[model samples]
Target: MRMMHNFFRIGGVAADLPHGWIDKCLDFCDYFFTGVVEYQKLITRNPIFLEWVEGIGIVSGKEVLSFLFCDFIL
Candidate 1:
C-alpha cells in the first residue's frame, strides 16, 4: 500500500488523471488489498472500470513503443 501511494504520487504527476479517477483507483486498490468488495459485482456495476483498464493498456503500449525506439537511438 505504501508503494502504491508512492507510485500514485509519481505517476499521477505524469498522467494528470482526474481526482474522481484517482479516488476510484484508490477505492479499487483498497478493495483489492482488503478483499472487501466482490469482484464480479464490482465489474458488473461499474462499466467505467473497464474504460480505466483500457486506458492503462493504451498508456502502457505508448510507453513500450517509446522505450523500444529510445533504446535503439541510445
Candidate 2:
C-alpha cells in the first residue's frame, strides 16, 4: 500500500496487472475489504455483460495451454 501511495504522489497509476480477470485481481484484495461482495454487485444476474466481456478477451486454446503454468496469487 505504501508503494501505491508513493506512485500516487508522483501522478502514476497505483496499480496494474496482466489479466482480464479484474474482479479476481490482487490489487482489489490489497485495498478493498469485502472485494467479493463488490464484485458480485457488478455482475449479479448479468449474463449479457459477461458474454460481451468474454467475446472481447477470449483466450485461444493454444494460448491457454501456454499460460497454464503461470501463477496468480491473491
lDDT of 2: 0.67
lDDT for each residue of candidate 2 in 1-74, tens digit (9 for 90 to 100): 54644666455566665567776666677767667777787787578877767658678776776687553421
TM-score of each: 0.25, 0.31
Q: Count the backbone clashes (under 3 Å) in each candidate.
A: 0, 0
Model 1 lDDT tens row, 1-74: 53544455643543566769978988899778775457676886777987667556355665777788985644
lDDT, candidates in the order shown: 0.68, 0.67
Which number leads on lDDT?
1
Span of ten consecutive residues with least summed lDDT in model 2: 1-10
Best by TM-score: 2
RMSD of each: 12.1, 12.4
Q: Cα deviation of 73 in candidate 2 (Å)?
A: 23
